[model samples]
Target: MSSSQLPVRAAGNLRSDAGRNRAEIVSAARAVFTEAGTDVPTSRIARRAGVAVATLYRRFPTREALVEAAFADQHADCSRFFSVVEQHPEPWPALRTALRRFCAEQARDKGFTAHLLAACLQGRAPAGAAATSALEAERLTALVRRARDSGAMRPDVGLTELHLLVAGNAGVVAASPPDQAAAASRRFVELFLRSLEVPRRSGAGDGVR
Candidate 1:
């Protein structure tokens, strides 16, 4: 091949390799983070990806960048679920489904649960995460408002209580053994949902507060 053609081919191959390396690094990061926490070393993720630490660093300069990339798909899943909830006609059922989904996700991925709790409760978000968090918050606020308006949810229940429910479920899942976490999370979600609903009453003013 001509020298100019050779250089072009080399450049194309290099770009292809770089893309592959990035994909591997992200896949490895997700697996490692799920098994261990996000605190695991970068070198370990590099080794798991079968890539050099330098390569991983080239693709993601910071640990948070790697983490954000690793969980990107999960975040997309969340956005999609929120969109589905927004379209549901019954606000209370939609809210309950969303809560159940969140608890199930926490049971499935401890690292993600820790990351989400830290982001939602502690107001910490990596580079591209802030916008996504804001969008989700807006969607949740609308859902809560609709539920309250429909009288299915207690008037006092709001985002703060919802955040508390999430934090509480995260703790429940974390404390439970692996084999029991999912069931425990489900039970916790049901209990929280019941508490958030308007109480049934047989007499006037009996269910107030």
Candidate 2:
């Protein structure tokens, strides 16, 4: 190959290697965070990625940057989920589905649950994460309002109650064994949904109370 072409090929190979290293690092970060929480050491993550610490640092300069990159897809998925839920024609059913999915996610990934809950409740997450949580919260509040207005949800139900339900489900999942966590979360979702639903009357004279 000509000298000029050699330099171009070498640059292309470098770019390819860099991209592969970045992907591996992000993948390793996700696995480590899921297993041991996000506070696990960067050196461990680098080892898991099969890369040097300096390589990981070059790709992600800060712990927060690494965490954010690791969960970028998760945040995107969450936003998409809420957007889809918002479009469902039936407010109550959509909200129920949303709760089930949310609780299931909490059961599946401890690190993700920590990040999302911290972002939503404490506003201590990276900027993108915080923004995603805030948007989802607003979507949920709108869904609750719609459900209540349509007499599908209890009149007293609101965003606070929903947040409490999520927190309670998170607690249940955290306490249960790994094999039982999904079941526990599902049960919690069912109970919370039942409590939030408006009572049905058997006859015209029957009162909801």
Candidate 3:
């Protein structure tokens, strides 16, 4: 090949190699975070991806950036789930499905769950994630109002309580043995949902919130 053509070919190869290395690093980071946690060292991820630590760093400048990329699918799924729930015609069913699906995901994906919880608590999520969270929160508020208006939920129930329910259940799922977490999460959500129902009273307490 001519000298000029050689440099162009070399650049093309470099781009291809960089793309492959970035994908490997992201895949490795996801697996490592799943088996261990985000706290695992970057060197471990590099070793798993069969790339140098410098390569990993070149692709993802910060640990959080790697985490954001690794969990990007989970984040997109959650965003889509919330959008679906927002469109459901029935508020109660939407609430129930949202809780069940969210908890199930939390149990199945501990790494994603960890990042989600941290993002919510620390206000440090990526821009896209933060927008999703805000959108979900707004939809949740509307859902809660609809549920209360329909008498499916108690008058005293509010949006903050729903947040607490998800956050608390996420912790339960995170703390349980991986094998049993899904079942446990389902049971917990069922109990919480039942508790939110407006009760039929027999006396003067009938209207109590």
Candidate 4:
């Protein structure tokens, strides 16, 4: 190869290798965080990724960076759920589905639960991460407003109340043993939904009590 061409090819190879390492580190972080919590040492993730600690550090820089990158999939899933909620014509069912699905997912993934709870507690997230979270919050607020306007939900509820609901659900997921977490979260969400709903006009109760 010509000298110029050789340098270009070398640069391309380095880029490819960097991409591969980033992907592996993210994949390994997901598995490691799932098996353990987010607080586990970064060396474990580097070990799982089959990379040197310095390599992992070069890619992620910090634990939160790795956690944020590892959680991109779950973040997308949450956005999808919000989109579904936004599209549904029936507000109550949409709200119910969103809560149930989100909480259930949280229960099933302790790593996600830890990530979410930590984000909530910290009150600030990395810029891109914070943007997605803010968009989710805004979408949920709109949904809740629509539900309230439809008289399907209590009129007094707002984003603050929804935040509390989510926090409580996260707590349930955090407290339950892994095997039982899903069921417990489901039950809690069901009860919470029932409490939030407006009663039917027919005076025939829907067994919420």
By lDDT, who's the top model here?
1
- Cα displacement (angstroms), candidate 2, residue 54, comes to 2.4
Would you list the C-alpha lDDT of every candidate in the order shown?
A: 0.83, 0.82, 0.77, 0.76
What is the C-alpha lDDT profile of model 1 across 67-184, one tens digit per residue?
8888888889888988888899999999899878877887888677667656554455644466676566667778889999989899998878987998898789889998998999
Pairs that clash in candidate 3 = none
Candidate 1 ranges beyond 4 A from true positions: 1-9, 118-128, 202-209
Predicted candidate 2 versus true structure: per-residue lDDT over 1-209, tens digit per residue? 87766645478899999999999999999999888778788999999999999999999988878988898999889888888988989999998998788778877786776777665544455433566667756676788788888889899987678779878987898799989989988988898889888877667666645
Error of 1 at 91 (Å): 1.2
Residue-by-residue lDDT tens digits, candidate 3, 1-209? 87766645578899999999999999998999887768889999999999999989999998868987887887778778878887888888887887777677667765766666544433445333556555555665677788888887888988657667778787788778978888888988888889898766657856654
Error of 2 at 22 (Å): 0.5
Screening candidate 1 with a backbone cut-off below 3 angstroms (N, C-alpha, C), the clashing residue pairs are none
Judging by lDDT, tell me the better candidate of 1 and 3. 1
Q: In candidate 3, which residue ranges exceed 4 Å CA deviation?
A: 1-9, 118-128, 174-177, 200-209
The candidate, 2 or 3, that scores higher on TM-score is 2
| Model 1 global lDDT (CA atoms, 0 to 1) | 0.83
TM-score, cand. 1: 0.83
* Candidate 3 similarity to native, TM-score: 0.77
Root-mean-square deviation of each candidate, in angstroms?
Answer: 3.8, 3.9, 4.2, 4.7
Q: What's the TM-score of each model vs. the native?
A: 0.83, 0.81, 0.77, 0.77
Better of 2 and 4 by TM-score: 2
